[model samples]
Target: MSAFPEFIPSKLSFHLDSRLVTAVAVAAALYYALYRLQKVKIHPNEPPIVASKIPFVGPLVGMVLDGGRHVKSIGLLNRDKPIFTLPVPGSRIYVVTDPALAAAVQRASKELSWTPLIPELTKRVMGLDADTVGVVAQNLDPEPDEPHGFLADLHDMVYAYLGPGESLNALSLAAARELGRQITAHAAQLEQQSETVDLLAWVQHFVTIGTAQYLYGPENPLARDPRLEQAFWDFDHGLGRLLLGFAPSLVARKPYRAREALVAGLEEYLSAGRHEVGAAPIVQRRIEIAHLHGFSVAATARSELSFLFAGIVNTATSTFWTVLQVCARPALLAAVRAELAAVVEETATGERRLSMEALKGACPTLHAVFLECLRVGSDSYTSRLVKNDMLLAGQWHLKAGSVVQIAGGVLHADPGIWGADADAFDPARFIRLGEGKVLPAAFRPFGGGKTLCPGRHFATHEILAFVAMIVLTFDLEAVHSDENISVPPKEDRVLPVHILEPRTDVFVKVRVRDARAVVVV
Candidate 1:
């Protein structure tokens, strides 16, 4: 007692004790709440068989990582079922597998609307303003009610710049001749080298040049400018980020220096103001109409770039796959070549080249080949969110705001619709149609109804022409005789990303074919 000091009380001890008690209570309450949530069975709205126990953000995180492998795996597991539900960020997604159910979802676009995920992504990568981007415009209160706001205006401008009609007149006989010359020049260089090149890359360059020439005319220096080439490369490089669903605001925050260079090149072309007297055909007429409708030329030009991006990328991918498949399959390849030879021989007038009609008639096999490739390698899908509570597949009453997806990959490979060898690549599958043989609802590669790709015809023509030229000029053979070719593994984090993704790297050695070697029937 003599050595001990007098005991002292401190206000800090009392404060610390109270705070500690409050923290523990809050933590305990959170734990109890989470435990209860885990115990609670999913509502009848969610199918019992579907896996939905993933915490918080759910399976979306995993789906984003690797092209929805978990979703696809679950789809295979539950193939017999009509519908299943899985958790996604902020909501649960119902995946519709039954053909009828998918049709219902696709048809109900007015009641169930598509979310413009990709368009939003495009806005970000293009480095446009939030208002120009149109994301969350509905929520901004006091939004403009004009019949044609930014998006509609942009669409009209793009249509004027590159859509079908007189607008495409500049892209006529002379343009075609120039294109042919350019293609031949490039092909000759390739033939001389005898080196295996990535056909898709070369085709992309060709399409870009052809598209620019059509939009800006031959006189515009940007049409032949080397600097424009670098800008396009930069624009393409930034595209991968958009496909990954990185925040548009973030991508927009950084100046797209390369894209700016492209825009600058375009400005120089616009400044020239040199119009070919008789050149204002369909394309020029459309531009006049656009101007009359109060469309801004600058806006039209910006929108045209978007058109160029969309027009070429998927078409190039499709063409690549079509050529690769034809070259790799020996019997199919031989049959196509034989068909072409017969057509050319029948129509050949010793002096003039094959007419458009003759070329069209000569390539039915080529069309069939293209269709088969589209069936197997189409990278598009349809999605919608429910607007009202509805029972789907005679089970699972999905509430309003729930998202639904129709799995195109699964549908394309469906054994019931396509036969036992659905997984195998067979061009013959599309060549003949039996009487009253119904195409399965699952056969939607261009999507269905209103949302179907509008440029389908243009794309088909482009692919056929490119394929015809390649097959006509070269004898194609696989570099590795025993190599197996298949679709590249799906990377689906970003919807619609599959359209331009390569399925596999195929090496084809091309040798110049004699004009008489293959008859173009």
Candidate 2:
């Protein structure tokens, strides 16, 4: 303790230094007190008291922590109410849940605009610059001067390549059937060899092949090429990154390297076709549309990838859930099979195969089951930015430029809209004109209003046909009986990625059923 020397101060000197320290402390306290008083004066908590503890970055951090579950939970908290305010970075967003409010938002499309945050995030991920972003933004907006040329061109392009009069539907149907046969054949081969394969991976492979055939044509390399097979796998892996608003800068710096690989392949494909104009109608059409609308090559590629993501991912998930639900509920399975038997018998061609019309009318119960699956499992949410200050939900007054969103998770399960058994997975709930009546406009799996998905009819037909064919041709049973095989619980965070994925890994032991032995309804 005495290793160091110390000098002792006089009592008078200590007292003098202490007084100086007290004066400095008093001045610091006065400055802080005044600063707090000034802050309170500048920023006041307005009506619809949204708490903002940290400015500009608080809500963003919160949403990231739980992947937007907090936003959905806020909606659930105010389900019965029309509107509530949620604090987002630099602004307060109103969460609207009431049907009337939703309708009002839909109707006021001119006054309100779809939030650009998501689209902006997508652009960032896709490496789009300011000019490309502006073009896409203009294209998405409903403008009086724009004349709907882009949309019209897109429709005609789809019609030309995949429409009823062209070879599109025939080609699509052939592709679907061939892919189905290939999948079943593979399954049979696996069974013969005593292989316990992953059903989900197999389904993904089937979907990837089928979808690639439809999009790029049966002659396209991706349809059969093994190297391009890895592209689909990469694309599938990149889907989560695309959806979760993963920062573009991160994608640019990450290991996935999906964007670079896809772009390189697409460029090579396009360059080889420069002298072969009109060789591929769909590809040509896409390029033409992009050029017409002044979108950059990258933007066009992103748009195509957007379509790929939407079609493959959602369809795969829906089909996966549909198969799982049917296997778990044997009564529902039997009902669908009985319906398929009658329809297939009446419409069987000389080849004893199901026709398009037969598939269409296969079973009311099957349709109900598909609808219920959609209602129970759909993961899309709708959002719009207010253009003018207005009162919402009869209470909260939102300012211009404020963002409002409706959580589909909460809306789909609202007791007031869907009755007391809203959360129950009952196919009869949607069976119109039979055992159960169809619900009202509240069931919006494809969304509602002017911007409703144009591909709804096609998507529905595809899903229904796939489900009916599977049920009619195969006997499916869940491998895990105790796993609560209904659609995965909505609130479970462990299944967040499941929203965009089909539970393909959930094994449903399947065996081919003889068509003749099955009883007709």
Candidate 3:
């Protein structure tokens, strides 16, 4: 069946003759091969060149198939090279390996840009209409009439909502409280009898509900469907394909269905006046931004779904990884719990609660564990479209219109930057932050420069809050007879948007912690 509806035509009414098509295809193939055959030369100011065996399409295909793995394969092979150029047909992409070069790339935004990619992403991933795309383009104008216009660049507007300060804190706090509340309720239910559950699955639901509750407010749409949490995971599983303009309806059918169902639910939720309730500043601003840009309610709802995806999907995965990293190591887990002991309070009625303020100030070990998890599990890649030819680091000449990629995993594992244990999970990694050993660019799990993740602060708070509830409130053990804590194999991981999540959900036997287990500071 065709991906488009029955009303749509399968092909244009007019077509070139078969013989002409054959001739054109042959010419294009010859052109591509010749393009590959041309003796490639790298100038002194240009980075070393690495050519894929398949000419124009090899690098793109490999990246599409296994993003992080492909990057690692190249990054590891060229340990001595701070950077390299991958030439694909019409484009030249510079991949940064060294932290110092990465910093230079971050500052070279004028020559290497991010604006053009945003509209392209929206059109493909969000399936936005041409008119809406125009609005996004206008907002992205670097010099708009109003410097702080609500309808400023899409990135800026999004940053406005998620940027640090009171607005972000309020949204984050609300989400943390809701997640904690739900986890406590779930714990209460499990306390009646010893129960088994998929550990990752439960945390996914908890974070999903908590995030949805805070973002969409009391009239949360995910609450309307029992299967939405799973549905979202299904869609997320195929996200890279969908984002690459693969016809998701045909290639990722289940994910497409899941996305459409969620979109419909979100549309209905807004129609029922649900967005009016629990509307935080971010949500309120998003709605206003869309309205001001001439999007209909349905279009606005669809746009919000993308933001909601950013808010919930990757975040839940990050939370799961953080917990798994901690739980997988007993010494680390004990240390983390002990760090929390200073801020954990047991009430007269035997209820235990974490003081967020105290944890923020006192829980250095937990913070270190969180940072280490991000470094070890991050798959985030930053891209910039080169606008003008320029020399990078006064050495490598970057070509105009080429795409530059800064792979977080590469920087995270840099030996000189992160030390001998760069590839190992060192929970106390960030404890040495003040020692001036690690470069500022060495630990950019949330990315850096203007394109830094606005949700970084919020995500950090929520993950810590959720994990605190679990470790402080429950005793957890893997249910499988042969298992203790089996982390998902690194080889099995696909390049996902956030930290890699286990391919299979982790099941555990859980019981409320005994009073003695709760450390009273």
Candidate 4:
């Protein structure tokens, strides 16, 4: 039998179908009309909206694809505007591009607060349970008469330890001492012979170990197991997706796995009583505070992961860039080396030591180089959720439930603040500005106000120490074909961060200096 049926219509069944075509066209037009209506409605009192061609969907998609670069592009396009609104599907982000407005946003701590997001981050990113999240959420925005809660206590504790005082000095010195020891050991290994290395990787490895050993003590998990260190970085790279909390195991598989490994290691560290034995006082206090707030040992460990990340990641990246900036430039390197030599002294036993205090206070040229590095290299966003409708700079109106992000990268690039050479890397920029002239308020590397980084003192000390050690003890030459060594382009497209990381590895030849030949003391 034939497969085809003879009764099938050849011509009668297929007509022009003008009616169906008309219906499709009408539906598409109507759908687009509603889509346009759904776009953000701006009031005269509100900051002017910078609308995307694709309405609400475009801004969100741009953020998902470009990370912080999208914000920077929008900023560059609207450099004259101090503030503008970016509307996404669910919310509006008021981007503050002007340094004055940025300062205002930070000053309005109660109206535009960072505390509101802490619970969400603790629950979703740190994997805390609902009860623990509730504990954190309580009194987040307490009334005038209401007593301050867990969050307040945590803040006070952190500030007490990390603020500019005796505790801060001890912590900073400990970190510096640990890093110095690592540098000395590494230099000894390179004696009389050059070793080629990926500069950023080399910096990250030692910084991670040095910072962790001091913060988490001898039983530091990252130092004990190298795999955990790799895992921590993997998790950091995928942090944007992880923050969304949308089935991370499926969407961000590698980062999710890495997070699990870190959490497990942290749990083991805490459970085995390693923290009590040799961990930093702040670390011990952190564990204690979490337990005080009804957190389980596992949840406490998970919470500690955020601390570990904050402790080392940006410091490592900043140190890498600072070292690169100084060493890549011959004159700057020579100047920094000479300045560092003032801090080096020899005891009666012939043991040489680099004075941490002198490095912090006496080395003006080195300090300038470090500050210039931060000014040009920092790409962080200082974000606050607008808790109440407020007037910023007594002009632009910010609505409640919206976010106000002070774009540090955009501000850093403002020629008005940083001079015409804002985009260029000038090691002497800070020195040129000098003490009599007030530095621009746009230089917000450590952020500002209540949300300012408490660890700033420690990070500054540790980075300077690392750089001083390297500059004094070794010679770093870029392993490049060209005679002039170039610094690597920044990895701007990664996670929105305080420090921009290098996009590519820079290979450099490291040669240890002869102790007898070098001018020390």
Scored by TM-score, the top model is: 4
Question: Once model 1 is optimally superposed onto the true structure by TM-score, how far is the C-alpha of residue 369 displaced, in angstroms?
Answer: 1.9
Per-residue lDDT over 1-521 for candidate 1, one digit per residue giving the tens place of the 0 to 100 score: 64343322345666788889999999888766754454333575565436444543446666555454456566767888777766554566777767877777766655666644434554555544454455323322122474553444433444454455553333433344444556566655665555565656656667667655654567543454766765675566456554444653366322366666665565455445542423224335544544554445553345446655665567766777787788767677778777766655433543113333445555677777887787777645577767777766555677677777777766776787778888877777776643235344576666765355555655665566666666766776656646633335433444453354464455566666633222211
Task: Give the TM-score (vs. native) of candidate 4.
Answer: 0.92
How would you order the candidates by TM-score, starting with the best? 4, 3, 2, 1
Worst 10 residues of 3 by lDDT: 7-16
- Candidate 2: which stretches are off by over 4 Å? 1-58, 115-119, 139-175, 184-195, 219-221, 224-256, 274-284, 295-299, 346-350, 391-396, 432-441, 480-499, 502-504, 514-521
The per-model lDDT (C-alpha) reads 0.58, 0.58, 0.74, 0.81
The deviation in Å at residue 81 for candidate 2 is 2.0
In each prediction, how many residue pairs overlap at the backbone (N, C-alpha, C within less than 3 A)?
A: 14, 1, 3, 0
Candidate 4, 148: how far from true, in Å? Answer: 3.0
User: How far is each candidate from the true structure, as Cα RMSD in Å?
Assistant: 6.7, 6.4, 8.8, 3.5
Candidate 3 ranges beyond 4 A from true positions: 1-39, 42-44, 139-141, 144-154, 157-161, 433-437, 480-483, 491-493, 503-505, 514-521
Evaluated at residue 101, the lDDT of candidate 2 is 69
Identify the superior model by TM-score, candidate 1 or candidate 4: 4
Ten-residue segment with the worst summed lDDT in candidate 2?
38-47
Error of 2 at 368 (Å): 1.3
Q: Model 1, stretches more than 4 Å misplaced? A: 1-49, 68-70, 115-119, 134-179, 187-193, 219-222, 227-240, 243-260, 267-301, 345-362, 387-396, 432-441, 480-495, 498-500, 514-521
Candidate 4 local lDDT, 1-521, one digit each (tens)? 35345335433344335656788889888768746654546566688888776667777788788878888889989998899988876778999889778878877888999999888986767778788888888887677588776787778899889988888888877887787777777777777888889888889888888878999999988877889988988888878888778988898888889989999999999999988878999999988888888888888888899899999888888888888899888898888888866667766765567666787788888888888888877878888998878788778888889998988889888888768988898867777777646334477789877878888887888788878877777788877646666787787775566588877878898888743221211
TM-score of 3: 0.87
